[model samples]
Target: MKDAIEVQLIDTNIYKSKELWQPYRARGAFGGQSLHAYFLLAGNVDRPIIYTVERMRDGKSYATRMVKASQRGKTIFVCNCSFSTLEEGITLSHQVTMPTVANPESLPSDLDIFQKILRSTKSESKQFLLRAEKNINDNSLIDYRAVNQYSNEEIITGNVKTDAHGRRWFKTRGALNDDMKLHACIIAYASDSGLINVAATANGLSYNSESMGMMASLDHTMWFHAPARADDWLLYDIHSPRTNHGRGVAFGKIYSSDGTLVVTTAQEGIVRLTEAEQKKRRKQLEFENGFLGNCRCQL
Candidate 1:
């Protein structure tokens, strides 16, 4: 994870990606690497990305910086981050209770799960599972374990419905230094992982589903409530409240192993069905509109 998000300071208030990491079959670079910026466009891995940071505001208690990322002379992403000094005498504090989940130690790793499926599947299905297994083994930087396990059938079919709720334990594979800023960046990078997929999971569609047309994060927002280590076990509890008009919204809470709510995240994204499904939807809409039009004419 640290290596995947590495950046170098090239000039004053300017940074460049040391190495770009793109997910398997992703259109562009991972969103989490952008840190606190709202993504305006997707940056291609073929080109180098340049980030220019502008000092927005600097005060005694608070500071703000705006980061703009560009690739190939096109603006790709933008974000504003605000920082505040820790208060000496803090009083009021409350947080939502973290949901109960299986301990990371007790749960099977994602690689193990994929390998199990790969062993049982036939030759025809092995191709996809093999690719998935290889990606998890080679590129995955975080150790992830899902709270609820899906069967091999469900995994192969790409239709695992869980009522729009998902919980998983995740943390960096290697120990990180004691720099809180770096940890926060790690959190930001990890947060974008599979978040938009929560919307697809709600509708019984996985990334490998044939019926899934397009799924991309439109915007992402996250808030840090307390200090936490990115290398330690953390539970991510997420759920999608609604999905409509090719859009879905999900909210997530990240909790430390000791049940401290350390981070909150909200994201909305485009969740579209395949072309065949979309055509059926369009026909249905046309029928309804035509019926309404006939009623108006009679009136």
Candidate 2:
């Protein structure tokens, strides 16, 4: 939730580069820009490109393209996307239904929750301190929340379980009225938040200041089944499938109120660790969880 991108269109007549470039900070590339560019490029083609996609996948047709967003040209965010053919081929259909969750109105806003958490802390978890330091100062179009989170320092020190799948509560915090496409694009922008952590969770590792290295999103994927509004609250259900060979795969489902499946996402990331780092982490985990404790397993 901390890293989800938020953009508000200043003009309805056109979307600009700043709007497109903002959400892509998760990756080195700009996702909003790519989405804008994708729309622009598709508009230029002669054929009618009817677009449709599943919400999440990994390396498949509907997976990576939907999430790997970039800026269109220098200003617009174009999601590099393709339209589907209307041809009636081998009829195949299957899907996972959306889960039932609390309504947005029933749940506290992320900001409220964050403020409460900060106020309640006594010992001052280092991980929370780091997150506050890195994120508290920013102003953006969208508001994101990690539904259940420990501080960044707690995570690295093995004070918390890395496999505790993250839940990010999010929505736009502005008055801008976004259309279906704009909302979908915004959701795409926000979907990247906490995706990489699924792998880290499995390994009981965290990105601490003392550690030397890099953590970045390599590729992202998502699918939109039905229309969704970014201005409204959405519950993102995420999980990790595998973590091995210095890499991890994670997937998620976005559900609207009344349990409608709006979107899905999948991501693969590079999780590099030298033997020394792994040993250090193992030692830390052992010290926290105990000598016989299962550091690699979590609830």
Candidate 3:
């Protein structure tokens, strides 16, 4: 997680990314590492990203900042963030009940699943696995274990069942310092892990599927409701409520092991089928229309 979010201060209210991390076959850097900001745009991985922070507002209890990320003088992303001081005492508080799920210890790490698939005898499967392996960090700082397991074949074929909802247990691989802000940043990074994919999975599309043409986040918002440790096991419960046209939206909640609702997140992104898939759908529609026309004439 440290490597994923490392940044160097260049000037007052300006920071530059020390390194950029892009997902397998992604057009731009990962969105989560840009912590506490919205991804208004995306750029390729060919250059370093510079972040400029604008102090929008400052008050005794509330503050706001606007962040713009750019590459080669072109703005690639912009986000508006607001912060609030912790209240001395809670006046009112309520959260929806956290769903019961299997413990993290009972599930296999995602890397373990990837390695098991790498031993497959099928050549096509092996090739796909090789490419998919790039998505996993070699020396990962975070541990992820999916609650609902799926094989690499199922994922590649877009046959894995998500029902528009998914759950995973995640945490930093090692203990982190007792900095609440740092922990929040770590959670921010992890939040983008597979959020937009939840929307695609609702339409039976996976990032690994040839039918999936594009999947990229357009905007992300996070609300920190309470303090939580990133090193402790946390449950990320996510669901996609809608996907229409070329966009999909998903909502997620992060809960501590003891069921404390720590954060809420929302994201929307581009989700589209490949041209081949679109063409196939068109042909099928034409065939159905022709068959129906003949039946009507006979009637």
- Which lDDT values do the candidates have, in the order given? 0.82, 0.55, 0.81
- Against the true structure, candidate 3 reaches a TM-score of 0.90
lDDT of 3: 0.81
Order the candidates by TM-score, highest first.
3, 1, 2
Between candidates 1 and 2, the one scoring higher on TM-score is: 1
What value does the lDDT take at residue 172 in candidate 1? 89
Please give the lDDT score for candidate 2: 0.55
* Reference-based TM-score, model 1: 0.89
Model 3, span 120-196: residue lDDT tens: 63536554666657745455667999887776667557656667998999999899889887888888878888888
Off by over 4 Å in 1: 32-36, 130-134, 280-299
At residue 218, what lDDT does model 3 achieve? 82
Which wins on lDDT, candidate 2 or candidate 3?
3
Q: Each prediction's TM-score against the native?
A: 0.89, 0.61, 0.90
Candidate 2 regions exceeding 4 Å error are 1-16, 19-80, 84-95, 102-130, 149-159, 162-164, 206-212, 274-276, 279-299
Over 110-138, each residue of candidate 2 has an lDDT whose tens digit, in order, gives 45554555666553557555554444444
